[model samples]
Target chain A: MTTTTTTRAAAGSGSGSGKSARGVAPSGKPFVTFEQANRRLKWALLAPALGFVGLMIAFPLAFTINLSLTDAFGAVNAGSSYVGLQNFADALTDTRRFWPAVGRTVAFTLGAVVLETVLGLALAMLMRKAFRGMEIVRTILMVPLLATPVAIGILWMLILDPTNGIANHLLGFVGVPPQEFLGSVSQSLPTLMLIDVWQWTPMMTVLLLAGLTTLPEEPEEAARVDGANAWQRFVHIILPMLRTTILTALVLRGVDALKTFDLIYATKGPGGGSDFEAETLNVYAYGLTFDYQEYGLASAVLVLFTLFIVAVVVVLRRRTERSAS
Target chain B: MTQAIRPRRVLELSRRSFGVLAAASVLAACSRGPQTASPDAPLRVLAINHVWTQAISRYLPELEERIGRRVTMRMLTADQLTSSFNVKLNASATDIDVMTIRPLQDQMLFARNGWIADLTDRVEGDADYRWTDFQDAPRERSVTAGAAVSVPVVTERPALYYRKDLLEDFGGAPATLDDMLDIALELQRRSEGFFGFVGRGQRSGAVTQWSSFLYSFGGDFTVDGRSGIGSPEAIAAYQYYGRLLHDAGPPGATNMSLEQAMPIFAQGKAAMYVDADAIYSNFLDDSISTVTDTVGFAPFPAGQAGSVPHNIPSWSLAVNEFSLLRDDSWEFVRWASSPEMVARLQSEGIPGARQSVWDDPATLASFPADLAEAMRVNAANGVGHDRPEVMQVGRARDIVGRPLVSGIVGEDVASVAADADAEFNDFLVRDNRQQEF
Candidate 1:
């Protein structure tokens, strides 16, 4: 919505300015042509934003790429000589940490986003028709999203504690054995995914609900009159209309899940615990950069991670466009 | 669309812009004066938020009066402090005049990078400072490449925390690792919810605590600058630790660090726990612990080579290399780590590295009798370091800790130790090569 609105507003203003420049006369003859004036004004308005982008984003990215090609270890200001693609070659061949981190990053994002989409669609359907206490329900749903990620991690640590947590206590009533959620090496990633799903499914529901409300009721009503059941109508008419929203939500949540660091860091700490079971790419890069101070190798890993994210985003966006067409 | 101005007009405009820029520069210069440290500027000290920092904060006014300048101490967690130093020191920031540091962990890296100021003259040239008064182990750790880069402030060694009530029938805390294991296992078999033992099981966090076990088994992280973990003694130590935790520790022990494991012992759910003696106050604090009355402290139990814990300067004071107020920074360090101040602080339950302070019985009055005795014995027999001494200590710890995690999870420790040893040997070679940079 933001993207579409911004583009339309800019286009409208641009055409309006062009038309007025040629059509209207202010005072007398103009010193400069319309194109010249428009060009100057556009540059005047864009210089500050351009400067900000260059300072804040482009400079650091360029610096990181440069550093990736050098042996920039220990101190940032320390002297370093170019080492070509040695850092990249080393990171790629590292079967111990780098590859496992990449695998975990993909697994986490895929599992969390898929589960969130399915559950979010269902919840959005349930909350489609406004009912009593709907405002309270929506507000309650926002609680998990409102809390800080570190606080959420610590809260879950307490809740999922193997010995004294209420989760284990509740499980005991149903004769289920106590389970280690974030504690076990094999279960840590899956446990964190459940937490992610809990926190972000509400955001997915809210986005999909907005998309659902904008849909025309005619197709669903026609399907119902043609003897189509609720399930059939949902699978046929509603889902097809909601496709764009689903994909948009997926891209948003998928990007976030891929770069998750705070919760993992807060819960499992550096190297993502004993066995590196929960070490995603973000965590691995962070440990290298900050913990070990291997800036060159870390920069290489970050460069690769950025490319991976870009590739994922491009693919998801192309899929979204295809569905929309 | 580009328009050209006359040459004379362009020259005039350029002169006017230059005049304006110069005026603005003058005004900015006048606003803050020069970019050097002034006499009245606060002596900024970046420190960890530990009991020593808290205790010293209360007496900061004294230091300010002594230095005749305001003192500002910013406290953060250990990790946060390290991160702050890395960024600020990398940029050669001068705001941090003094900082608390972990000598064993950061001094080598800091000294190699020239991020910490050399203090050999200040420590040795001034005879009244009594630099040699610090204990041998901690004092040696203060120097890197024959230069004193930091001063040991707080010293630590592991303590055996056990339930006096639980071990009463067993006569007391176990004197050997084998006896402790048996008692812990028997206790576990006797109860359902109670764990027999609890300690750090997280890979990196557990390394320092596990160092005692390694040394007690007559093993070291390295032997003659090569990997030592694959040796029989080291492998046996690994297997023993793995079995101890796997058989008697709580389920999901691999996830427990000091923070997580400490609570189990504090809550009276575990029979025995081992961790830094510096944190003994936590168990005694009624607000956070339930077994304060029944808690007993003992030296690290004997192993194949008898009891040998790690004696380390867990926290120290150092001057930033880029600090403008070098003399003032030295003065602050001199005052904070002096024999008089060490005795005063140690008397208040904060441990110090001064041997004279440790020798005095009055300073130990604040600590529990058994705990004080345990700390003394451990200090006497302790090794100098708890982890491998290297520039990239974090990476080294990660490699050394893998086998420890395998042991805790009941995996085959021998195979894991061999793999980790090979990896560590390769890492050491690369690490030495990187040191040339």
Candidate 2:
């Protein structure tokens, strides 16, 4: 919901897709002026980075687009006959696991992003004023973010074990039956969300804190000097001014949440939480590849999953722009 | 009472020691060994059991004396073995000398693709290598052995563990599979959270456990690897299993794994459950299971024809064709395989790969009174050997097994089985076969 309301920042489309190769061919020719060449050399030095991005990101995206057309399991040589959008049809309607996995992916992303944005902004506001042991506190908060997700999942399993876990023991202190946390279908997805919140709330907090620190205090001061109180200043002035930063955090974190795999896989495994409860789109695709070797359908699922992401990001980008304007 | 020689804990940990290490350290430290082997380096052996804890903890002194070399052992999961060595054997020379994995997962693709070294010559002349002592059932599993590619480790299975006190409180062992079902239903009627039946129904591993029931009904995964999932018997089997879970299992039966099912069974929350034998050993310590002394075992209740249940295999050690250490590694392998080491295994309370090990009175004394009897019965009747993964079995299980079981409970069986048969047969193409059958 918040993603849709956050507009794309006012830099305009930054990608250089409009120019033709022929038009730049002469300009890209070897050996210009020494200073000009020096600038070109700088770009030439950056060529490796750009190439790395292409290999790692752009090329894979293009390859994924190609792979989306065929059945590509983990092994490249594993025989997969090319089937068009049949995988798409199978994933969406005929298959139960893939469709539910998509739904869980959407729910997890929404829950993680929306929660992080609210909590993170609040934490930023708290940290903005600073307090006793504030540095130590912030450092303590960041530890969750630093811990490996798989390790975090394992740690939580111990804490959440029904018989001997500290969580159940604490619950028993209040006289509740020891609850099955990760093992229960009703509890697993939410449990994973809780883990995501623990590990990533600090990431949002740090980002929002940076945004808050960068904000001009003058606007808040002016609002404060007016009839506006703390709540009003925050609601009307502070939030609106920090709108773009919050949206940026939303997009960055939101995309990561959509692709969240390590935590779920660690917590529940390839079938995506037991009974497919914790399975996100990534987990579904992976299970299809490794667990069942349904490469063709997995690729189809990926194709649809990629499209779903683009649609969400595009809608969010537009929403952010509208709010900014 | 005579001193209770606790079943040989692979870790030598008392239940109290487990109290000290707890689940976190145990699982974390579980992945404990492996140093990469370079040629001219100490022979690198990647062991999948207890990460080398069983070697380090259970048999270190003997392993040292027998090998006469400072052999390195690396431990990791069954899945890890699949991930690492499958590639090295395919890519270049691998340093791994011996690898252990579940027989079913010891895919023929590995040997078929030349990833496993041919071992016919290795088994014959090697003085220490003795193949005759193993159970004959797993012969189908060791097909890669043209001579001997893999050695049987232990039979990993989930036998029917019922409350003997409860059964004696009730009556005799259920005479038939339907009787088992009726007994479970009757148990659930007592308003006890303790169901007479417990299993995974989560559609992941649940599908596999459910298959064991199907097998008891005489269903098979293979019909020339084209899949017998749609057979009339299989549909009947799925319907029976589905109803058993729906009517008799816990509210969250669909989601239970060994981790969940074991606690309920231990706490008297579940009266009957079928799962891996690993739980039985862990439960016997008294700290984990208060009913340990009273627990009873039987072949998973049989069908009308009294067909026994099937289970996933416990892993055995196989030398990758790419492994260079078969010559040296077999020395330690032989020592470990000898009757003496098996006796040590029996002393520990764990069963060994050797059939002779089961004959030892000491080993029999280590387990509960009923368990020793059930182990023999199940071994006689149960499927301990590896059944090859034919055709798209991996696919059929997820696509057919999961859906079939679910649909039988939620919808129809005939249609589901038909759908499964079509899907399974479609997957029977040459390239898709993957050297499994």
Candidate 3:
């Protein structure tokens, strides 16, 4: 694309005289090359996007960072004084809520993303070839993704109710004991992770399927002709080629899983149940800001959360790049 | 050359765009100028989606006519209402003329930020409004730092909900906690899927309901302005509640909030439930409840300290401090919380904070005979606040609720209460310090 644009620019410039190239501007400034004019045009075109970024992301982030340093509690416009790193120190030193939230956030993301990737890849492979009812199956898979998270949470709550829920009834049929899904303090986080997997695995499958369609059929066919088994062919040929797509899916799903609020909040509510069992960092920070009105501390927690997310993305991107190379 | 002409064209295009942008910005700025109350502007009310709000909304046309303006009422869930208030009020929004606020939960924070208008003169000076006619407990909750910042609209107290059919063999609803427990255990022993007791066991959500338990056991949330949750009375209260739930309640009782636990009783799966009296309609509603005919209501059972239930103004009406139509806002609050309106609404099965309404037999005629009797008795013996009174009520509830959950999960209540007491003391100090501003 760049080469084609450069060639067109070169031809246009060649058609002009050398005098025209060195001509004075209307403002009597020195003449510029085609490349210099192109750069200026590029910047002009990019200005809106850059401005949007500044307004939407940069400004709020900078404001949050600034607010993190102050004792901005109560109303947003209320008087506040500089508190330096006291808020950050308080969050870091806190072991009860903040640290548990951090641990849950990491565990939720890692567990949900890894499960989604493996299950998604397997589903993608299963549906790779044309089937009798492929479209219907694919359409059905999209239902969970299309429905709102809060609705899904509520539906799951009913389905998992200890006494009245169908889940326990099904377990009874299998002679298994009734399990407290969302109701149990120890099971809420894992149950939510499983729900996350259920909702997002299809998303990963669709992405992986798209990548699968783009891969050349030559490698798989060659492996089949060389006496490779199905698992051998998948491991040796298909998996390596699907590495980039897998990493991309992981990053997308992982970030979303980490920042999950609606599902957990809708299901477990504020402080994430009686034991703070399912409270993630997002839920924690939200309780701080809206529930407790601890704006300074919430801002500090948010800053740390943002850094953590960015670091995760950077590490995953590096892995993807290395794998591709 | 083409390139030179293109550069000039680009510059002209950019200049035109900038000019258009500048014009649009100026127009936008003009449109957002000072929001003075225009005659055509609606008297905006932000409220929770409660029965009281729904009932009041049917009579909004009368309010609008009386105030000489259109009225716009927006209703949201409890959490959504809180979020909207925090975000909009923090920005000094003038659109919200009247807001439904929780006196025990949000009045302090709202008062601290000066987000709610002081209605001392409006409520007190106006004899027709009859501020003193409100029940003393709920009426006192309307004041913050000596100024009446809100007017009580909806009053709630805990009620002991029992399955009348199931209690036939047990003679009736138990009058004491021990009797209730014994009955609950006996009832549980007779059934396979039925639970004896179900109530809110959620950490923060359970505190309000648990307040009655703590009080009946001869403890307050605070003693001498310090944490009282570590007191022996408090721990014993916690242990008794825990044992009642753990032994006779359904599996996963700790996760049961009002929304979860209420349904168990409504569905006839639980024999007894103790929760806010405001939700009694859920038990009566045929669509949601299976045991509507057999559901029975009684006052909170007695404990070591006798019957002490929390009679709180669960929902109240407050005018926004930043409202452009302050007079209209006050008029709305005054009109909605008027003795006539309270009596009228109370007759419609929505409990109001008026003493005259509670005393009137005609108003009591709407509710079930036993339920009305139970409500009156609870209110007469009720405490003002259900949860801790603080600027950060949610955090305080969390700190105070930890031991409750610990006890529910069959852990050591005394140990957890001690740890929670220390943490709560620290929180109280920080909260008090923060409240200075």
Candidate 4:
């Protein structure tokens, strides 16, 4: 029904645009000659490109949504019947792993994005003044972003290795006990969030920096000239202008946090994930599809996950647009 | 449009005609495609891990040639083998022919679900297929639902490897469970920086190794394959394991696994470990192991089940139910399991799995003379117990491995054992069974 309405609106607007050109000289001007055929030709030229995009993106999404509706277990084709809402029901009610996975996904996204946004904002502000070796500092900051995630995970794995690792050895000299950095249930998730922050804060910082650089200086300088303190200037003058970018960074990092997989999986072996403490929603879905061969459940989880992301995005975008205005 | 009003145009194109032309061309290409690599064409068979590839390639290179097809080999990760392309193999029509499976996947899930093709009749009928060489235990473990599921590819059992130097300093390597206890105690008492033993006490596969001790102590996961790991023997195993950890093993061995143990043993920080012999190369390689010469192998401590070394599983080569090259795949399976291939590979100094090859003079000669003696002792006892998987064993592995890790970290023997056993029968079998439905 919505599709029909959308198509009607599209056609109405399209033909309305064409109608303006229907009469050769609507204004009865001597020099003007507009033709509907030329407008039709322009639309003809646009259709193939638009059709190509619709086929490439929209078709696969439609197919995925279709598959998501079927009860498709791995390697089972005949039994893939249309089980419309069963998969969604199962995801919401899955007692053992799925619900816990959703909880963890929320925690991970909130923990990572909140911490990263704050830290990134601080780092961006601190580095904005460009005091010393600024170019070199910026160059070094990109290293974490450039390194391969799995390799970074393994590198951390060795350093945080409990017995023979340098991390423990260094701690040993200080009379601090050797800690199970990635191995303990208590520490695993936070450790992963730490790794995420390390690798990605630079990205957030760069974004905020771009926003800060583009920020109007007149207000901040006006507050300063009026004898307003540095902190007051930041709060009243600087912060109001930075809300859109800050929220943009949060939503971007929030999405990334929910999908974080490589570092967690690489650092901890399958099923051995920090006492199952690190099993986030993405990891749960991955295990279902790849580890357990439950594609139906994985698709359901994905559908639900996509819905959650879209909800968060909608909420954040509204705030961003409000702040931008 | 030509204004002829001709029936010829309808015959030439008319969307249906174009579709027919396109489909015919597709069918022609598909028939000649690699997926259609007949018993006469080169069959692209995928093997999981390098071990499966080595074991299957042992016999496939020659056998497939004899079967009028050349079997091309591809190594896949175990995750890849279990999940993705096999579904596409039939529908999407890909090139993968035969693939690898394991007890974790093969037993009923592959056969009952018909993910793997039925080759029992074909495998039994093949002149080259040998059913007698493998002992009854391996065979029973290999088959599923009265049908052969896979050709047993890589088989292994764990052995207790220790530093000869650490043991000699502590009075000698353990010959019995009591001796192990005494050594662990004394080592804890004497060593300033040394740890007594290192094992996989982590939540994953480490829990399985810990269970081997419990099972060997006459505990069972289930009676008649039902949940029963809550017995007194299980308690005893857990208690003894906890005491051993508290009194002797490394401080955080509770979370240690192959990733940690291998490197620690290699660096001479860990004194003893019970793990796969496949990991021997990392410990015995002089370039890696600082204590290479000082390392020695021993029989794992005996429990009530006697000193049957616990073999979980490696990987196995199986013909896919959808596999096009049945005869060729069977030939490859047959060649991989034969005594000759085992002996030949052993001679080449690859330490993975080929039981018969250990007795080969050349293979024994390649090992350091002392380690060779140890290898002989291990070859006698080191095919560990078959994995405790039945169906949906992945869940069971997680459930049991978790409590066992909890047992390692702090719980008393009987309590943790009872907790584990109770959880297994209730949470895993009973709850999970209803849950799976």
Best model number under DockQ: 3
Tens-digit lDDT track of model 3 for B206-309: 88999999999999989988999999999999999888888898887888888889899999998999999889999889999999899999999999999999
Q: List the residue pairs that clash in candidate 3.
A: none
- Judged by lDDT relative to the true structure, which candidate is superior, 2 or 3? 3
| 1 or 3, greater by DockQ | 3
Ranking of models by DockQ: 3, 1, 4, 2
CAPRI tier of model 1: acceptable
Models 1 onward score TM values of: 0.92, 0.76, 0.93, 0.83
Q: Quickly count the clashes in candidate 3.
A: 0
Candidate 1, A242-318: lDDT as tens digits? 89988999899999999999999989999998889999999999899888999999999999999999999999999
Using lDDT as the measure, the top candidate is 3
DockQ of each: 0.36, 0.09, 0.50, 0.20
Q: Which ten residues in a row have the lowest lDDT in candidate 2 chain B?
A: B1-10
User: Which ranges in model 1 have alpha carbons more than 4 Å from their true place?
Assistant: A1-41, B1-33, B189-191
**lDDT (Cα atoms) of all candidates against the true structure:** 0.89, 0.66, 0.89, 0.67
Tell me model 4's lDDT, rounded to 2 decimals.
Answer: 0.67
Error of 3 at A296 (Å): 0.7
lDDT by residue (tens digit), candidate 4, B330-361: 66666666667656655554443444454457
